[model samples]
Target chain A: MDELMEVLRRALPKVNWETDQALVDDGIIDSMDVVSVISEITDEYDIEIPSEEMEPENFNSVQAIYEMIQRLTEE
Target chain B: MQSIVEAVAAHARALPEKFCIADSRRELSYRGYWECISGYAAHLRDLGVGVGDRVVVRNGQNLDTVTAGLAIQLLGAVFVPVEKNAADTRILEIIEAVEACCYIAAKPMELSCPWEKLGDVLSFRDESADFETFPYPGGADTAEILFTTGTTGKSKGIELTHRNVVAVAENVIDGVEMKKDNVEVIPVPLSHSHGLRRYYGNMLNGSSVIILDGVIFYKKLFERMETFHATAMDLVPTALSALFRLSGDRLGDYRDQLEYVQLGSAPIPQQDREHLCRLLPNTRLYNFYGTTESGCSCILDFNAMKDKKNCIGRPTCNAHFIFTDEEGQKIEATEERPGFLACAGDMNMKGYYQSPQLNAETIRNGYIQTKDLSYMGEDGLIYMLGRQDDVIVTGGSKVAPDEIEDAAMQFPGIADCGCIPVDHPLLGKEPKLFVSMERGAAFDPAAIFQFLKDRLEAYKVPKQIEQMDEIPRTYNGKLQRKKLLELEAARAAERSES
Candidate 1:
């Protein structure tokens, strides 16, 4: 989780991807940011994040993103 | 007709029961739409709103918003629409800038009374009010004051006349091949000119419009389209890209029903364009290139010009474009020496609101010049090469960021990219690129540098390539190169501190 957060921090430099951060609702991450985050996460974790699974809930924070990756990996 | 409001009122009298505007929850017939406009206009009139007064209208994409806008115009007042969900501070700033007579919000705001509420206005509609006899200003009268997206304190209000709005709508109708029976689905912001003009044009042709708030509601959006049996839709590139992502391969299902799709306000990626073409093989896809100040200047028939996707096709409707050098000399269409793009026609704006200096600088001899640099190809199509301010002066040579960005987009693993000039001790300034890579792709700045080196001149190749999560853009999705520069500067400050 820390490693995932580190990756996000470096890629999305001005963003606060902490556990409490509301990435979408707070306007922290927009559609363009979502695109980049998805691409980076899938490549780094060797997981395929399908378009249907791309929802705001799954990516609202670093913790949320990490959990989503775990769920996709298990699937 | 002097204005769209008067024409729409006439249409209402002819066909009172025809559905003019519809959303998920409510629908307004032409008669009902006209009545609502009149009622609102009367209410505004009671509030001391009259001719030439600037009214700040902040409402999301909906039926009431459109009608309220029409009502304001009916009273000969200029409607200044701020983006829905804009912060109160931002709204206040714009209100101050325009010296708006009254502020109207879709929902309740923190501001006190005298600021009209849209919900209250909608509830007080006078169904018997006759709107046709209401005197509207002539063609040259200012109809709207559209504020283009800009950084704080630099927002320029574009004053568009009745003729300007109607001309752009007509240009869009012709360019997109819209018909009277066409049911156009509008999912973009109603505040902007593109979406507003598309609605106005359709209304002029007596066509029905379905308003969907956002593309985020994919299920509801598709359901609305199917329910309305929509034949056409208009959206900017960002919205279209998101739709493509959300729908994936399923977008092709509507190809038969959707006659055409208009995309503008930002550049569509070649990959996205090609994929969309495949998805809607029979549907006509257009790359509409125009400005808020200049309506529909150029429309590229992407279906026919598949080989020249980068080319913005010849001028549309009554518009005429010319490339002018620094000395204001018109450069002939010889496919060489790119220069500033200047436009002349009915589509051009009257001028910027309250800014005489800017009006003089931009509009010269009835020709409105844009900062965008372009060249007229031998094929007679216009090829844009980024903004004039985007040119990097390095080693006594000028390099356009569009060429570099386009070249970078072709390299594998890169999803989106932008290039900007960075100060250098040696060359004065050098080009540096910021890229947002494809998900799961490896970071290889060296590989990208080498790839660009192979294709471009040495000075054109970026000195540095940094991977970023996203590119800064305006609310309407225009690339904010100025914001990117600020971000780079902040990063440099952090680096020096470390």
Candidate 2:
């Protein structure tokens, strides 16, 4: 979880993310940011984040992103 | 010589049943669109929105907003369309600039300034309402005031006359070969000149338009395109690049159906242009060069000028372009001497709204000096260097970031990239390359620099290169080099303090 937060912090330097913040709804992040996050997570975790899994639900929050990574890694 | 409003009314009478504007919810026919425009005009008249009054219309890319614009013009009032999410401060600035009488919004915009909701505005809609249709105060009358993107400074309100709007729409019709049967998918905000002109062009030609707004929903956008059997698309370079990223080879699937694709507003990498050319060989791919103030002056038809895809082709329609030096003396178009591209044409703007100082500086002797730096080749094609302000002076040599960005984009792993001038102790300012690699592609600085070195002169190569997760851009996808420079400066300040 610490590593995930660290990766996200480096990827999105400007964003002050709350664990349960509505990233998309609040306009805290955008699609381009999502692309960058996906790339960094894939590179770090060595897990392929499929296009279908690229949804706001999995990426809307820090905790949501972490859970998505855990699920992808376990799979 | 009719105004766009007049032309639209003509279309309404000529093709009453034809679909004019549409979104996911429902579509409006020409007759319906005209009635709504008339209704909105009558309502605005009741609200004291008289001829030549400025009305700010908020809520972007909606059917009501579109109708309200025509309605405002139909009553001879000037409409100012702004982005829905624009800061209240910015909106206030615009209202002060124009001394706007009333604002038409979708809902209460939480603004101190008075505003009327679209619901209330439409409730007073009357189809049979009779108003002074004109003495058609459109030709020289200010029809719309579109604000500049303000990448460098405060946004300037560009006052476009009805004649300017009509000329620009006609230019689009001629340049892109728009027809009555064409259905163009427009995702660009209605607030900007680029998107609004496309809407007008389609309406003038009695064609259909699909309005899609917000972030790039690649799957949904393409799905809507397929559903509409959309014959055309107008977008910025970023959106096209995003589509390429999302669709990849599948983009070729729309090649047969899509008659043409127009890319404009910013300089796109030449490699991306060529990639698109190869991908959609059958579809007419155009890289148009124009500004909000000047309208579209040049268009490069990649299908026709495959050998010279780097150049923004000869002036289109009534546009006349001349390259000039710093003193504004005309410089002969030559490969060796790149100069600021200035334009004089029917489509040129009247002036910035309420800004005589800026107007005097920009619109001098009828030719508006653009920020674009370009030189005409021996073949008479204009090759764009980049923005004049974006030119980097490094070690006594000049470097255009467009050239560097073009070379960088050709690199296999590069997904997106931009170049900005960094302050140096001795050499003054040197360009530092900021790059975003392709998804899953490894970031290797040495290899990338090597690739750049092979393609460019030693002086043109950036002194430093850094890989970023994303490159910042304006809402319309223009590279925010100034912002990037500020970020780097802040980072340096932090480094020293630590």
Candidate 3:
């Protein structure tokens, strides 16, 4: 979970991954940021996030992203 | 000359039953579009939106926003469309700049200007009502005020007269050969001059435009295009990057169906241009170079000008260029000597609103000096060396970031790259490269620099390299080099503290 937080931090350094609950909702993170996160996680975790899985819900918060990653890895 | 507003009304009368615009929810025929425009105009007029009044509009690229724009124009009021999600400070700045008479948004927001929620504005509209009439505005009247922060750091409102708007649209029509049947899919914001002008060009030709906001649902967007039988698109380079990343070879699949694709807001790299040319050989791919100041000036057809580099093509039929030195003396850069690019035409802007000093410096004899280091080749096509402010002065020689980034884009496993200037202790300003790796591609500084060394001149080679999660770009997909420089500045400060 900390590792996922690190990846999120690296993707958008200006963003506060810890406390910012509505990352996507608040417009702190945009479509481009999501793309970067996808790329970074794919490179780090070696898991391919399919197009269908690239939803706003999966990336709105750190915990959501962590959960999504776990689901993909488990699969 | 028929103004853009008049053209819309004409299209309504001439092609009443033909398709006009479609958002996510519904589609409107030319007649239906006109009816809606008229309906909204009458309502706004009642709400005290008078002729020549400036109206701050929220542009979400929905049917209401687009319809209301025409309504504002119809009333002889100036339409000031801005991004929906723009910061409150920025919106306040614009309102104060124009002394805006009213602000129209998607929802009710407490504003300095007279506030009217778009839904409430449209509630009084009766679809069954007769056509509302107003005096069509003259060609010289200010129709739209587009705000841009380019050229100077501060925001400046660029006034586009009805004549200039018509000429800008016509230039695209002639350059891209837009037909009546072509349905252009516009995901870009309408507040932007590029997207708005593309809309005008389509409307002028009696075509259709579909508003798709972003690449969040781009796979569905591709499917929507297929559903609409979309034959045209006005896209930026970053959107192309996102789409390519999300779905490989999807756009290429629409080569036959799409008649033309107009690319603008930023210069495309040579390899990507050539790759697109090969992919969409039949599709007329136009890489246009223009600004809010000089509307849609240069357009290069990749299918025609294959294997070209740094070429922004020739000035459109309406525009004529004069390259000059720092002192603004006209010098035709027919080959090697790149000069400052200036353009003069009906398509050019009137002048920056209330900015006399900038107007004097930029606009001369109807020619607006574009701050780009450009040269007209012996082939008569204009080629950009770089933006004048962005040219890196390393040692004695000058290097354009476009050259570095374009070369790096061809480097193996590189998805995106930005070449930015960093403060060098000796050289004064030095080139540094920041890259984002492609899928499954890891950052390898040694291999990358080695590849760049062979391709670039020794001086042009970046002194330092770093991996960016993604290269930062404007919403329109132009490389935000200034942002990258700021990032470098912050890094330097951190280094000093540590």
**Can you write out model 1's per-residue Cα lDDT over B344-419, one digit (the tens) per residue?**
9997999998899989989888888877778888787888866778888787787878778878888988988889
Clashing pairs in 2: none
What lDDT, from 0 to 1, does candidate 1 have? Answer: 0.80
Model 3: docking quality category: incorrect
DockQ, candidate 3, vs. native dimer? 0.22
CAPRI-style class, candidate 2: incorrect
True contacts kept of 3: 0.28
B11 Cα displacement, candidate 2 (Å): 0.7
Ranking by DockQ: 3, 2, 1
Can you write out model 2's per-residue Cα lDDT over B1-498, one digit (the tens) per residue?
468878877777778888787764457777777777888787778888888999998754667778888888888899899886676788888887888888887555455457887645445556663334544555988899998768888888889999999888877888898878999988777889888888888887889898776334566567778877899988888777767766676778888898998888777767777888888898988877788887777878877787773578978886888989887889885656688899999899999887899898998789999777788887777887777788888887778887898899999989778998888888888889999997799988899899999999998888699999898888777888887888888999999999
Q: Any runs in candidate 1 off by more than 4 Å, and if so which?
A: A1-75, B110-113, B131-133, B151-153, B393-398, B423-430, B450-460, B487-498
What lDDT does the true structure give each of the candidates?
0.80, 0.80, 0.81
True contacts kept of each: 0.06, 0.11, 0.28
Task: DockQ for every model, please.
Answer: 0.10, 0.14, 0.22
Query: What does candidate 3's lDDT look like per residue over B308-358, in tens digits?
Result: 677888789899989998888998675467899999889888888888998
lDDT of 2: 0.80
